[model samples]
Target: METNEPNDGHAGNPFTQVPIEITISVGRARPLVRELLRLKRDAVLPLDRRVDDPVELYVGDKLIARGELTELEGDATGQLAVRLTEVADLRDGL
Candidate 1:
């Protein structure tokens, strides 16, 4: 049976216009309780990954993509940005 539902895919979906928040995970750090408590101002906490490691992008707890950290040039100089290296297929939803 013919229906009135739009056939234009997400372009016709109202929710597609909604905004979402993405979380970027650079790395993780594990420290003993005593070490955590010992943290003071200016204390350096080492992470498990190096600066060149690919960072993960997540929507809530689900990872959506991986990318490299980069600094914007020109007018937005010094602003941090992510250059996506890998992206998950989200056709089946998050």
Candidate 2:
């Protein structure tokens, strides 16, 4: 016996191109004591990482990419240097 498949003409392909906004996050670590003693005009705090370190990128709180900090025309930007991890299912959906 053969099975009959339903063909609605659009069941095989049901996805449409759309614009999506990706939210990114950058992490910075600093001393706990410095945070506790923060002043209005004091600048004695030191960050845990250097300026050359890569920043973490996130999508809705999920870590997705890691990239280095870049300065484009004096504006700070995050350059996608590496893709640490990605959602395989999400890629397929796209």
Candidate 3:
């Protein structure tokens, strides 16, 4: 049986603490089969996007947001991060 119980907040949700992985898609490469097979160490595979192009963030197969790649400063210097530029309306679902 199902009942429409009164909802409080995230504290009552079991999935609140569940971990999910978000993938940041920078760009794609479409190398030919022969070209792919000829790849070796130190070979540069060029992508379709420039360095400053916006990257897409995806949760599974769903695109959630778009952002730009940036480098961290301070104690976490050298670490790469994303600066969100656009976010999708996810009120309906993921």
What's the ranking of the predictions by TM-score, best on top? 1, 3, 2
Candidate 3, superposed: residue stretches over 4 Å from native: 1-9
TM-score per model over all chains: 0.86, 0.43, 0.85
| Pairs in steric clash, model 2 | none
Query: Clash number for every model?
Result: 0, 0, 0
- Per-residue lDDT value at 37 in model 1: 100
Model 3 global lDDT (CA atoms, 0 to 1): 0.92
Candidate 1 whole-model C-alpha lDDT, 0 to 1:
0.93
Instruction: Kindly provide the TM-score of model 1 when superposed on the true structure, using C-alpha atoms.
Output: 0.86
**Which is the leading candidate under TM-score?**
1
lDDT for each candidate structure: 0.93, 0.54, 0.92
Task: For candidate 2, write residues 11-80 as lDDT tens digits.
Answer: 4463633455555445455567756576457555555666666666666765555666554443435434
Q: Model 3, residue 67: displacement in angstroms?
A: 0.2
TM-score of 3: 0.85
lDDT tens readout by residue for model 3, 1-94: 4448645454557796589999999999999999999999999999999999999999999999999999999999999999999998887674
Question: lDDT at 42 for candidate 1?
Answer: 100
Candidate 1, residues 12-94: lDDT per residue as tens digits?
A: 57897799999999999999999999999999999999999999999999999999999999999999999999999888764
Task: Indicate whether candidate 1 or candidate 2 has the larger lDDT.
Answer: 1
